[model samples]
Target: MEVLIRPDADDAARTVAGIVHQALAEGVRTLGLATGSAPVGVYRELARRHRHEGLGFAGVDAFLLDEYVGLPPAHPQSLAEVIRRELAEHVDLDPARLHLPSGTAPDLFAEARRFERCLTEAGPLGLQILGIGVNGHIGFNEPGSSLASRTRLKTLTDDTRRDNARFFGSIDDVPRHVITQGLATIGEASHLVLIATGPHKARAVAAAVEGPLTATCPASVLQLHPHATVVVDELAASRLEQQAYYRCIARHKPARHRY
Candidate 1:
């Protein structure tokens, strides 16, 4: 795993956008996307590049990380609508190629199974962009989620719901469940890029990067991935015990290396 500590969130986003640009240059065709405050800057930076630098997503297939179970498709706060407004509308990515979990599927369980089957049948993701929850969860796979889990429905923890309440207006308004790609499902991606920021994320970042690989901190599953990059601002990297080493490693990385 590679840890990159940038000066601030915008800097980290730009650096991540560079990595995505390199992947696109290398012909990456499938992108796994995340939605949250942590990754919004990255999407915005990518959009800016698309508008000004000729960067494009015309041929890319985007797969969203998760969706709330009870939200309607048109709900403004729904992950689907969020991605559409924040990314799809701003990029050249074909709408027909974008895939999001069916939050309102009549058979939600079947829908989850179908999504996993379709993902694996299609092949590994070119890249998976991620955002770490304050509690160290990835997607909606909260603490205690099985390390080898697959796409499935999961109940949202109170902590997670509370964190997301800002978008829904109140804690009680937040969706209680969601459909998320599992850790094992996410692990199938050829590359994993996790973005996190702020002092509030420091402990989670440290636990993910330096703590033991355990389901207690679900994001720690990245440690088992062959290619994983953890991008964060200095504030988020504060709790990492090997902060100096991480900085030195990033500083010495070959200029041409993507991550």
Candidate 2:
């Protein structure tokens, strides 16, 4: 993984925004996307660019990494709606091109298979955006998840649900299961951009960037990707073994070294 330590979260977000714009210039349409706090800044940066920098997302296709099971698409806390409110609505994206995991499908297994088929038809994704869970889970691929797994329905760990509960009105309202793209599926993308920020993510970010390639910390699977960029802010890089190199990089870009 190529680690890029920015001055702060916003600088990291701008770096990601530049990558997104480059992808668009290359005629990219399908985006393997993720939902969570780490990526919030990225979405905000892209929205700002779309509005003030004369950028657009008219033909971009969005595919979420996962969605809570049993939640209606209209649910305010659903990934579908979150993406819509946070990013889609703010841009000129086509509604029909927005692909979300069907949380309430009658036959979930079939739906999972169909999701893969749709991806196949859409052609290879130009880039996949990811956010590392505290437990190192990527998408919903929890610890011990096989690297070869595909899109499927899986139970959400209590820790995961609790972490997500902040988005809902209460902990009781969060779903306990979800369908997500597997490690193998996400790793298949042409480019992988994993954004992590804040001190809370230090341990996980360290594992993803410098630890062994293991399923225990699923984000470590990023090590196997051909082209992966691990972007994190200074606080999140606190636990990294390469902190000195990161400090050196930041020193050169004083404007980006906010913290």
Candidate 3:
């Protein structure tokens, strides 16, 4: 695992965007993505790349990590709509290649199952983009989430609902249940890029990078990944007593200067 601490969020976002483009250039046609403030920078960077660098996703397929169960896919707060407005609509990626859990499906478990099968056919994902929850959750995999879990619907913790309440008008509007890929599902990706930012994530970030690979704090599972990169801003990495060690492993290569 490698950790890259940037001066701030935007710098970290640009760095993540470069990493996304690098993965794409390496012939990765399928991307597993996440929805959260942490990965918004990566999506923004991808938008810029498409607008200015001719970065194309013509052959790329995208699979979202999770979505609220009760929310309509058409809802603006829905992860599907967010991706459409934030990234997909602005890019050249084929709509047919965009895959998401069907919130409208009568049988959500079946929807999740079918989606998992799509993943098997489309993947193992070339790159899986992630966000570290303040509570050390990943893709709605909350505290006590099993390490070898599979795709399924899960109940969101009060803290997660409160954190996500900012996106909705109120906490009441946040769905308690969600369909998310299990820790095992995310772990199957060939490469993992976990993005986290802000002081809010300090303790969790510290636990993930420096702590043991345990299920108590789900993100700590990254410690077991062979090709995982944990990208954060300084504030998030603040609790890491061994900052220099992580820094030395993540020396940056400027996107502009790389070619």
Candidate 4:
């Protein structure tokens, strides 16, 4: 995994946005998107580029990473609605081309199979964006999730619910279950870019970028990917042991691999 530390969240977001923009220009039309504070800035920057730099996503086929089970699609806190409000609405992406798991399906197991099939049919994602949980979970794949798991229904842990509580009225309002793309499924993307910010993410970032490959830190699976990039603000990179080495690598990155 390549770790790029920026001075701050905005700088980090800009770097990620540039990677996405460049990919689009090079004929990448499929994207796997994540929701949460970490990626909000990246989405905002992309929106800005769409408005000012003529960046277009007209033919893009986007897939959401996960969604809360039992929540209505129109729910303000739903991942689908969150993505729409944050990025889709501002760009030229077609609603019909944006896919998300059916969170309210009567048969969630069947829904999981259907969504997995949809993802497979779309072919490999050009890029998959991710946000690490305070506990190092990716998507709704909580601690102890099988590294080889696939798209499926997962029960949310208390820590995750509490962390997401700020988005709803209270922890009680947060859904206890979610349908997420598993680690194995996420690993299929051609490129994986994970964004993390703030001091709260420092330890998790370190564990993911430098720690052992273990299910305890689900994000650590990035280490096994052929093309994975972890972009973080200085605060988030604080706990990483090889910060200097990562910086050196970034500084000497070859021109063809600049992004």
Task: Encode model 3's per-residue lDDT on 141-212: one tens digit a residue.
Answer: 999999998888889999999999999979999999999999999999998898889999999999988888
Which pairs of residues collide in candidate 4?
none
lDDT (Cα, tens digit) per residue for candidate 4, span 73-147? 889999999999999999999999999998999999999999999999999999999999999999889989999
Question: What TM-score does each of the candidates earn?
Answer: 0.98, 0.93, 0.96, 0.98
Identify the runs in model 2 with alpha carbons over 4 angstroms from their true place.
246-259
Model 3 bad stretches (over 4 Å): 252-259
Ranking by lDDT: 4, 1, 3, 2
Better by lDDT, candidate 4 or 1: 4
Instruction: Give a tens-digit lDDT track for model 1, residues 91-199.
Output: 9999999998889999999999988987887699999999999999999999999999999999999999999998988999998989999999999999999999999
| RMSD to true structure for each model, in Å | 0.9, 3.0, 2.0, 0.8
How accurate locally is residue 234 in candidate 2, as Cα lDDT from 0 to 100?
A: 85
lDDT scores of the candidates, listed in order: 0.93, 0.85, 0.88, 0.95
Q: Candidate 1: lDDT over CA atoms?
A: 0.93
Q: What are the per-residue Cα lDDT tens digits for candidate 2 across 52-72?
A: 987788878889888888989
Prediction 4 TM-score vs. true: 0.98
Candidate 1 Cα outliers beyond 4 Å, as residue runs:
none
Better of 3 and 4 by lDDT: 4
